[model samples]
Target: MPKDALISTQSRHRMTTRIWHWSNALCLLILLMSGLTIFNAHPRLYWGEYGANDDHAWMAVGSSQTMGYLRLGELRIETTGALGNWQDSQGRTQTWAFPGWATIPSHYSLADGRRWHFFFAWIFSVGLALFMVMSLWNRHIQRDLHMRRDQWRPSHIWRSFRAHLDLRVIRQTAGEDYNSIQKMSYIGVIFLLLPLMIFSGLAMSPAMDANWPFLTDLFGGRQSARSLHFIGAFLLLLFFLVHMVMVLLSGPFRQTRSMITGGEGKEPLA
Candidate 1:
């Protein structure tokens, strides 16, 4: 008999957890790709453009409002002449000019973008909720990600931080299960990114606004919710990028295969 066979080996994963994990991953990828395509219509951020400003800035689909970012609604309008003058929120008139050689704002179907986003959003939400429920029911959240109070101490955090900064961590645990660094990252995505994305997205919709008036206050305002949505998207994208790198470094095939097959022949422990 193999010597390792003498040691007790507990199952590392469950079918439900494995399914949820891969489902979430797939949905997130779809959402991210579609989101990028939508944002490419107006990839900019702006401040103090919405509401009674000076108190808050605004972020929309584009990088900045000054960029004359194209919107789906105006996608059908073809411009024949120089960009005209537009008014800023402060009641100031400004000329919307673009270099002759530069790309001009192209009109697109706002309805189409909105439809795709809203539809995919439902799948994303379902995946998120299912993942959360399973994680909570199985206590996997606590089991896999939550740090005990002792581990939350300054020394532990500092150790993880130093390992991260020194690049030693990447060398030590490239794949396998999540380390402390990964636990923190996963926690952020599960609690912070998922909730923020859902709530902010809902807050922007009129139907949700009518049902949950306080949501606007929670996020400041509708436009504020829109801003939060964009910010949340950026954070999710960041997580996705890091996650892909970890998978690649740790051995994508095995990691992905394990997720799909629930770890070779490992069975549920309980």
Candidate 2:
């Protein structure tokens, strides 16, 4: 066999990370779609413990006789034919928070949506817990994902940021791992954003609230928890978009093959 072939075939992603990565991807897709479907059941958001059509909403999506509007506090903007209100294929008027295309089943079904969301939520949560334990045990977190002391410096961060803006990715050599921005983004998503997502989700659940009232106190109220959950979902979506863009920019085939087959293309050792 050629030397380059031997080097290129070496593993880049660990078996565990690869499995978790794909599993998490599936779960996230299901959860996001179903969650949006569920969101359509309540298109309004409030700040306090109680809110409904009778009470003033901080944010709401609805339609009047003539046009659809999205109201944010005192401000309102027309959102006809997209959000708030639109006509379906049957030529019937419909009002929903998110468009049908953005949701699971592409039609309204609160019960089905909740079931999908909860089922995937459990899988996602359990998978995350197991991944965290395995990562810690294998020292993968410490060894590969950790930011070096030098990377914490403003100069290093600025340099990395500049490199990213210039579309100059620092490719990983045989022994090296992720670049500074990659490490930071991974840390933020895995350690910070995900935990917040899970906690806020639990806080919004009535069953969980009954079992652990402290969750409600921690997040202020159920409405607040719901708001936070929406925010977390948005952040996760943003992360996923950026991640896909990076993979394409960095070499889609190479990056995807690494995740699928756990191999990296040959690179000179640093």
User: Top TM-score: which candidate number?
Assistant: 2
Q: Which ranges in model 2 have alpha carbons more than 4 Å from their true place?
A: 1-10, 64-66, 87-93, 170-176, 265-270
TM-score, predicted candidate 1 vs. hidden true structure: 0.68
Whole-model lDDT for model 1 versus the true structure?
Answer: 0.60
Q: Give the runs in model 1 whose Cα sits over 4 Å from its true position.
A: 1-11, 36-107, 165-177, 264-270
lDDT of 1 by residue, 1-270 (tens): 333222113335567777767777766655555555455454433432245323322332222234343333334222223232334345544333322222211223345546666676788788778878877876777666776676677788778767655455665554434456677888988888888988988887788888998986688877677667777877887888877876676668777776776555432222
Looking at candidate 1, what is the lDDT of residue 154? 77
Clashing pairs in 2: none
Give each model a TM-score.
0.68, 0.88
